[model samples]
Target: MSDSKHRHKSVLKKTDEELLTDDLTHQLALHTRQGHNKFLSESIIPLMLCFACPFFVRSIVFICDHCHGSIHEFLQRLLFDHTLTLKDVLENFFFFKWHWPSAIIIIGFLIYAIIMTMLLPGDEYQGPITDTGHIPIYRNNGFCYYIVSLIIFTILTVVLKLNNLSPTYIYDQWDAFLSTVSTFAFLLCFCVMIKGKYMPSTNDHRSSSNWLTDFYRGVELYPRIFNIDVKLITNCRYGMLSWALLSVIFCMKTFELYGYTDSALITCILTLVYLTKFFWWESGYMKTIDIIVDRAGFYLCWGCLVWVSGIYTLPCYFLVTHPKQLGFQLTILILTLGLLSIYINYDCDRQKIQVRSTHGKCLIWGKPAKIIRAKYRLLNGKESESILLASGYWVLSRHFHYIPELALAFLWTCPCGFQYILPYFYVIILFILLMHRAHRDDQRCRLKYGDAWIKYCDLTPWKVWPKIY
Candidate 1:
């Protein structure tokens, strides 16, 4: 094994960037040898860490809320207060009762979404080519769907005067809503795994021998059911729409309880603007890591179905219980920060989309844009060129958009104060999630573009933070 030892020594002598490139290449080689798609990993252990969140993190959050949003009081009461029995504690903190109303509502929403997809008129957009030479198609009806859904919701609550369909109903029944969503998400994950394994709807699939990985990591990149795009429905329509609606509901709840508060108003406005921007840029998002790289299983499906609803709305949810007035000065400061962050995030995406759409003939900051002609090969040995924008915010960091995203989350949640860490949960989780995504995206692009990706990385070394990361 002298040759092997010599090779290892040679690798050890390489520069950091070279070493990273070699490691990425080695990982791809291993995946190829293992008969797995080199583009999508067989094991998603890093992502699967989120699996524990539903069981553990959510349970703790529920318990904290149950104890009136006081973690210390909850612990003290649990340890010292012998009035609570084991059964009572378990039933209250851990066990979730299946509320028929919430369950039916969630199911109805899904069915309604499916029906809307079938009936709605939307522009057809083609996605990036997959490893299996399939180009997935998506409907650009997200913004229209969002507007229609909001109007209908408003009609149901204000015009129809249905108490059950009130805006604050979901927040009122938070635990039951969460329970129904988690159960549905779990069952949906199983169905997608089965479909990907035996009844794949598209040629863009990569099934592994391991069923668990297939279940968690997903076997298909773009899996459709009943002529509707599954990712488009679950991610954009259901999950994201739910997040927006929940923000409105939480704000309504806060007003209903504590009257008008600038904190809630600011939070609600910023959240809507952010989600509106998302719908406005929905087509561009289809090429992102969530849709393009991650598949349609537990990590994505369950995440959209459950995590987005539960975790992403943590700030708004927290404000419902702990409503406080930040007055004018602090509120204005937070609002300004949140708005600026949203604009930066939007501009970052716009810049990249403009550069690519114009084929790098665009201007950045009123000057000619700088870009790299990065080339990559398709699975069928066909070569293609991609313009990598190295100007504007992109020059600051590879994933500079994520910085503003994090800042926006923090700015909105900052009004919750530091009395308890519950409100900061969204910011904390988003930080970890974005950091992982940035790294995962770097590795994926490195493997896809090889030397060209290496050149881009050399030109932009930072992942998400400039001069720091």
Candidate 2:
């Protein structure tokens, strides 16, 4: 009887496996068919529609707020009555044709992609499920879509370069093209990707006052598409887009400086490298980091990459290409600042991670305290815990990482030469954003740690910049 029961259990397990395998195979075949059909539909689409986008944008020169009057009346008022100049007309034309439309289209596509991807079919059989008790197949699809978009955008950029289009021409138009295509591709792939669950479902409620509940709530607002949560919006799309846009601007400025030089190539390479890094860090790699910190969002990462990295480093390329235009002393100073800032930032992160690994708890001053509980989901739906450390660098300052970050920003913006308002805009923006982040963080900590946080704050009072905030 005992032998028969054991054999029955083994047979049931095998049956489950067979069922899962068949389901997966059927889904794969369906996806292949769908892909072929999609490709055919796209190929048969009219070429005129594809080519006519630029011209169509150019033709619809004016966009009017249709509150009381028609577009014709609005244009007449602005052009004739307002005495708008040719420059004004040109500025409005580009802004409408590219800037506004691109922003709307990209955002719309991302949202739609995320939603559709979640609703698609698939299941989790191999890995641990997420909070929804399913594998994160949608999140994987979102990542794939983002990668495809980036490749498409890069190709378009290369094509523009090959055509010898003036920097100004590319700058004013390429963004729109990239944005449109990326958004479209994201939507396309999102519609077809297989689904999987990353978290198992559990109804065991130990208590209503669980700390994990608060954390989960926080994660919800952390900004995600479908069920895939991306913690850092600024670092991913925003940062990459900012760099691309800055590259266009830099190219124009570089042309004005040394005509055409190898410096331009260097700048392009660096920009691409940074963009690639942004994607890598924002994807599953960052998700792994979340497992450690238990803070799975990209808010801080996004802010650093987009506002800080994009605004600062990208402009330096232009300055390097045009040393004479920016002056010698200023250039050297900017480069020095950037190098130092990067060094400090890396050091801080390295120290923090090392500290966490070696010590089971964070050490403030010389005293060690137990903190940072690890939470995981198992098949039977129960919580488990393990110890995490914070000994080395974290003992020094609560947020030593913020120092290099601010420094890097200051260094990158230095090359703008303080000649125009746009150049220094980065510095102003970073200061404001960081300050806001610091304040928000403070509030969160205050709520989370209560007396324990108060003690931590007492030990290390400097939020970001030491002795400044």
Clashes of each: 0, 19
TM for every model, in the order presented, reads: 0.88, 0.48
User: Predicted candidate 2: what Cα RMSD to the true structure?
Assistant: 16.4
lDDT string for model 2 (1-469, tens) is 8985575444434432232234332222211222234334333332333334333333222221121213455457667777656676555433333355555644654464445445433332222233324333223333444556556556766786789743354334443544343333333222211111122122211111322222221222223333354443333444455555456456655665567543353344444443444443333334332321222212233223322333454344435323334445655565556566655555555444444456544454456643454343332444433333233444445656656666665555454444434434455666786677566556534432345456667666667655766
Worst window of 10 by summed lDDT in candidate 2: 192-201
Query: Which window of ten consecutive residues has the lowest lDDT sum in model 1?
Result: 25-34
List of clashing residue pairs for candidate 1: none
Off by over 4 Å in 2: 1-162, 166-168, 174-238, 241-249, 256-333, 356-396
What are the lDDT figures for the candidates, one per model? 0.79, 0.42
Cα displacement (angstroms), candidate 1, residue 349, comes to 0.3
* RMSD in order of candidates: 4.9, 16.4
lDDT (Cα) of model 1: 0.79
Model 2's lDDT to the true fold?
0.42
